[model samples]
Target: MKSTMANLWHLVKGVQIRDLGEKRYLFKFFHIIDMERVINGAPWTFNNHLLILHKLKGGEDPL
Candidate 1:
């Protein structure tokens, strides 16, 4: 498996934050110049879903 630093480097080189909204944030990642346009376009919504799933799975809160 790749180390965390390698993964982070890839992520950083490929991804960018586009916007932050009240309920969500937007992001984009580049893979191919014209063929692919990856758009997260809603970070907060994803985070909320993850939190809900974690709670349902009985994961301990880090707070």
Candidate 2:
């Protein structure tokens, strides 16, 4: 899943997706612009399953 998403985004600075259990993932991008681009592109998918993207502010809980 990580490799798939990484390739899909083709981010300049790159990104890392950490499995957060129960199918949730934390996508960490090296650059702000890369992050913004992914967010703006929204509604991503994998294996026909919709991949939801969310931005968590500082101190915000992902769960």
Candidate of highest TM-score: 2
Candidate 2 on 1-63: residue-level lDDT in tens? Answer: 878887888889898778889989898899999999989998899999998888999999988
Residue 20 local lDDT, model 2? 86
Please give the TM-score that candidate 1 achieves against the real structure: 0.29
- Please report, in order, the local distance difference test score of every candidate based on alpha carbons: 0.31, 0.89
User: TM-score of each candidate?
Assistant: 0.29, 0.90
Note the residue pairs that clash in candidate 2.
none
Worst 10 residues of 2 by lDDT: 1-10
Q: Cα RMSD (Å) per model?
A: 13.5, 0.9
Off by over 4 Å in 2: none
Winning model by lDDT: 2
lDDT of 1 at 30: 48
